[model samples]
Target: MNGGVLRVKHHLVGGFSTVTLCPKVTDHVREEIKAFLLNKANAKAALQMQQPAFDYDEEVEEPRPSQPNLKKRKGPMDKFVAPTPPDVLKGRKDRKDIFGVCDKEERDNACRAIAKWFYDAAIPFNAANYDSFKEALELVGRYGSGFKPPSMYELRVPFLIKEVEEVENQLVEHKTEWAAKGCSIMSDGWRDSVVQKDIINFLVNSPKGSVFIKSVDVSEAVKDANLLFSMLDRMVDEVGEANVVQVVTDNASNYVKAGKFISV
Candidate 1:
């Protein structure tokens, strides 16, 4: 200390301990500080000496068996351990695919492949959440390896045509059910601003299922009694007069007036 006042020097104080300053301790502290500065200067000199003045190939040491290092430096990756997976089927819910028998790497790769397809093909994220999407993947898995997917042409043309035919076949069955059980011709009318039109949806519902017959844009349609009668008459004729047990429509003045004219 200068002038008997304690002037705390950070560098000099490095070698001090919790002991109060005394004549004997002060001398020992001074020697400790001297040793600390000397060691630091020697370390700086050794570092400079180890670095090369010019860039050169590093020395290749002889290959030796690696020994475990107790003083090894650790980072996030070095100490990382895979977390234990949860029991999916432990509670009320069914088992999840994440905890399936397949390797985690394999599952991740397959999921990545599907995700890439979505990105590349511009498919929506909601498509993955669809039940059909799960069913499709399960079907492909059941088919095993070497499964060739349908081409764009098949999806748009021949296969689509077959699908249309199948729908028509289902319609024929619906028609049969309508005839046997007698169906109701239901009509719902609304003004759609999107299409800028007054629309009416015609549905033929039976015990099997409801079938959408057609949507008529009645925005500019003639609201006269004869025209309304003709429309209702046509609808009844399409469903077959005998099969149509009831004709349900909105109680609009024009429709009510037209219904009185319908003999059925």
Candidate 2:
């Protein structure tokens, strides 16, 4: 009966239990095994949750809108207004008044009136030629209607002569001063109206500005070196060699020779 009871007890124990532990096994070992099994099960569940499922169809993208054009439109008749001519805006009555009276017409009378106005106003007649005078006349006509103009030649010649004389007088006065102090002289010849060749002497003072046409000596043939040299010599004599510091002239052979002679 004891043997039979022992056998039954052993059989029951073996059938109910999976492992058999000896008395040498610790409690910590059992706890470590439980923790390892729990961690493995949690890791498998997290991996399954993180995985993404794939779809086979292509993605549809949205279209971008086009930009609008911003160009400026030009209108017709943008360049049609004509500019006014200078002479018309200035109120020039006649071509002669604007230019000066060349012919002995009504314009000539107008030019004379303009000259008289200038004279009365004490405006210096420095206008170089009739052309310039005509411009002045036109200006005067624009200003006043009562002016009685003179013949263009008549109005112009006297004014020019007066101006020339005044300039010549100033030149002469300066020349005299240049002579008092030692000065140099320069000269050249050129043709004038009526085809007369005139010798123009220029006086240069180191202390003052130079003077031209202070004295004019006319010659029948200005191209003649001997005549020009003779004229220069006479000028040098008048000024005196002691007062005449130097003589400067163009590169003409005659001028070179004259300069050498004068230096001596």
Candidate 3:
């Protein structure tokens, strides 16, 4: 190492092994040995290179065929041909004559149609202004034929009762399920801001979910505990007394007593 002879010897004495160094390495000899090892490792690495064995798959299993790529296409359409022109626009008189909407019979039909739309859409009956609806129809009559709108009496009185009957039928369908799953009754008292009236709401809760039973107007007798209890008891009877497990109400003293009365 660096022009000095280096020797290493192993000795055995008294069954113990010892290593002896000759011309113990100096700093120059240590640096030379490190450089020689570094160069030898680089030469060994440069002698060989690795390549992926592509045929290894064949040794494992047969090769699969490559799939062809397919793409979606709209395909060719027939060459464009011009279409026939439509009939000319009709004047107001011509439209009235053709559709016959100006006739008295047609006018009544139009009024019924408008009324049905209001009912099915659940538009507020009392809040609606019949004059406003008539004015709107008059505006539509400019391009079309004029129509007579129905009176509020026709829309509210009859349609309201029809809506009630339909809702009752639906609740009847769910009554059996509610009884099977059991239900809770909740009573709440509050003031109706718009009507300026006291109201008590009753609701039924079952595994199927909650359904509103009814709202009682109690502005006159709201503070009467006996009357409140009777109203709630009526609801219990309606829902089937056997189906109700608990009655819930607000912390108000009257409602608290009402709950106790129902529980008993």
Report backbone clashes per prediction.
Answer: 0, 7, 0
Better of 1 and 3 by lDDT: 1
Q: Taking the tens digit of each residue's C-alpha lDDT, what string does model 1 give over 161-246?
A: 99999989999999999989999988777888887988878899999989999988888987666877778789999889999888
Off-target runs (Cα >4 Å) in candidate 1 are 1-134, 223-226
| Candidate 2, superposed: residue stretches over 4 Å from native | 1-143, 151-165, 176-182, 189-210, 214-228, 239-243
Error of 1 at 91 (Å): 16
In what order do the candidates fall by lDDT, top score first? 1, 3, 2
Cα-based lDDT for every prediction = 0.63, 0.53, 0.57
Q: Please identify model 3 stretches exceeding 4 Å from their true place.
A: 1-162
Q: Please, what are the lDDT tens digits per residue for candidate 3 over residues 116-217?
A: 988999988764577866665544553233234447996798868898899888787668767787888888888989979988899988877788988988
What's the CA error at residue 101 for candidate 2, in Å?
Answer: 27
Error of 3 at 40 (Å): 81
Model 3 — TM-score against the truth? 0.40
User: How many pairs in model 2 have backbone atoms within 3 A of each other, for residues 3 or more apart or on separate chains, i.e. clashes?
Assistant: 7
- For every model shown, what is its TM-score relative to the native structure? 0.52, 0.35, 0.40
